[model samples]
Target chain A: AQSVTQPDIHITVSEGASLELRCNYSYGATPYLFWYVQSPGQGLQLLLKYFSGDTLVQGIKGFEAEFKRSQSSFNLRKPSVHWSDAAEYFCGGDNQGGKLIFGQGTELSVKP
Target chain B: DVKVTQSSRYLVKRTGEKVFLECVQDMDHENMFWYRQDPGLGLRLIYFSYDVKMKEKGDIPEGYSVSREKKERFSLILESASTNQTSMYLCASSYPDSYQPQHFGDGTRLSIL
Candidate 1:
């Protein structure tokens, strides 16, 4: 079965610190990848997506993710964290065309 | 910009009552979907409609029915609401072509009493 796994259930980082959220996917072949963030009482917003090309993709709000084929991972990263960056992040994609399978999600906390 | 809109942000209903959730897309997307979002389960697909009157069962479709009378509107219906059904419901739409990023609505936080 195809599935997305977020290794870290919760991660806390001080404001301005570098951040990384780990994600691993299970599939028979190369899969699609995406990163999304959900704020409190809001819907999931697309941050970045990886389809076929370059392993690294940039997304909105200064977020980026790299797809590592060897490790079956697509980890999200940011150089510096901001207070507004605190939100639940989900990793998904690589399903039947547009069908997306999302991970359990990692809750990010940015402390000042 | 692609815009998907859900009818309710929060809904409260008694157990055994029928429930309706409406979703509309302004981008004329050919595909629309309903998903249930829970604390640890993430987003589970409920139902999807590719076109008007055409629907498919997603990962979790039991106790739920969908309607797509028009090309841009999709509706999710719960046969009977239950306390266990309380969840955040999300609506999304995308182009029929491959790899289209789905646009999501703000979501509806449903509560069953």
Candidate 2:
């Protein structure tokens, strides 16, 4: 079965500090990876996705993710953190036709 | 901007009552999806439609049914509402034959009494 793993359940980073959220997946073929962010009481917003080519993909809100096939990892990164960026981050793998297998999600808390 | 709209932002239904959650997308997307969001569980796919009148079950499809009479609209129906079914229901749409990102609505927070 295809599955996504976000190792961290919760991560806290100080404002102005760099942030990195780890994600790994297990799939048989080349995978389509995505990162989504959900604010409190709101629907998820797409942060970025990696389908093919360009191992490093940029996304909205100054977020970028690097797809490392050898490592089976797609980690989201940002140069600086802001309090507004505090939200739940989810990593998912697409199974065609818009079907997504999502990780348990990592709750990010941006501290002052 | 691609807009996906849900019929309601919040809803309350009694147990054993029938419930309907409607979603519409305006981007002429060929694919539409329904998912439930819960704390710690992230998002779980319930059902999806690739075309008009064509539906497919996702990871979790138990106790739920879907209808897609039109290309831009997808409706999720709960035969019998239960407390466990109370969740944030999200609707999304995406284009076919492309890696385009799925656009989402604000989501409907449903509560079962």
Candidate 3:
């Protein structure tokens, strides 16, 4: 079965620090990768997505993700983190059938 | 901006009662989906509708049903609500293309007592 994994359940980082959230997937072939963030009581917002071209895809909210086929990973990163960036992040992929398979989210905490 | 609106932000229902969660999208999206969010489980697709009157079962659709009688609305139905059914239910919509990103609603936090 296709699956997405986020190894870290919770991560804490100092404000202004660089951040990387790891994600790995198990799919038959290259699947469309995506990252979404959910704030305290809000719905999820799409961060970035990797469809085909350029392995490095930039998304809204100063976020970017790199898709590495070799490792089946599409990790989300940011050069500098802000307190407002503290949220639960989820990595997902499309099953090519309009259905999404999502990872067990990673809750990010930023400390000042 | 594409707006996907879920009917309720919070709800409480007793076990064994039927519950309905409504979702509406203004983008005229061809696909609408229902998912449940849990602490350690992230989000699990409950059901999805690709077109008016068309529905499909998702990974965890055993206890849920969906209705898409119109183009802009999709409804998730809990036949017999249970305590285990208490969850943050989210609704999303997207274009028919598989690559299109889904737009999510604020979600309805439902508690089954």
Candidate 4:
């Protein structure tokens, strides 16, 4: 079975601090990976995606994620955190077609 | 930019009532999907359509049905809504290629009374 896992249910970081959200995927082979952010009462917004090219993929809102083949991980990172960046983040993987399996999600809280 | 729109942002319906959630995508993508989201569960695929009039069941499709009469439009119907069925419904579209990322709608928060 293909699945995505985000170990942290929630994380708190002070504004200007660096952030990292861990994600692990289980699949038979390499899969398409993605990170999405959702604000309160709003829809999900794509943060970044990794298909096949570079290991490091850049996304919107100054976010990036690195795909590690050996670790089976696609961890999201941001050098500096902003208050507006506080939101629930989801990690997803697709091995076949366009169907995606998503993790439970990690809620990030940035304190000023 | 790709745009996926849902018919409602908030909906309130009674149990045993028929409910319809409409979604439209302007991207002309070949794949469209319906998902239901809940706390701690993230998102679960309900149904998906790869072409007009073609639909496939996702992880959870027991009480739900879908229609894709037109290429750009997909509808998710609840035959008999239940309290446990209340959730945030999301629609998404993407190219048929497996590598392409999906674009999402603002979502519809439906409540069963």
| Candidates' chain A TM-scores | 0.97, 0.97, 0.98, 0.98
Question: Measured against the native two-chain assembly using Cα atoms, what DockQ does each of the candidate structures obtain, in the order listed?
Answer: 0.69, 0.64, 0.82, 0.85
After superposing candidate 2, which stretches have Cα over 4 Å from the reference?
none
Per-residue accuracy of model 1 over A12-89 as CA lDDT, tens digit each = 999999999999999888777888899999988999988888899999999999999999999999999999999999
Model 1 chain A scores worst on lDDT over the 10 consecutive residues at A92-101
Candidate 4 error regions (>4 Å): none
Candidate 3 lDDT, A1-112, residue by residue in tens: 8999999999999999999999999999899999999999999999989989999999998999999999999999999999999999999998676789999999999999
Preferred candidate (TM-score higher): 1 or 2: 1
Candidate 4 lDDT over A29-84, as tens digits, reads 99999999999988888999989889999999999999999999999999999999
lDDT of 4 by residue, B1-113 (tens): 88999999999999999999999999899999999999889999999999999999999999999999999999999999999999999999999988898899999999999
Error of model 4, residue A2, in angstroms: 0.8
Colliding residue pairs in candidate 2: none
lDDT (tens digit, per residue) of candidate 1 on B37-86: 99888899999888899999999998999999999899999999989999
Q: What tens-digit string does per-residue lDDT give for candidate 3 at B1-113?
A: 99999999999999999999999999999999999999999999999988999998888998899899999999999999999999999999999887899999999999999
* Docking quality band of candidate 1, CAPRI definitions: medium
Looking at model 2 chain B, which ten-residue stretch has the lowest summed lDDT? B95-104
Give candidate 1's total backbone clashes: 1
Docking class of 3: high
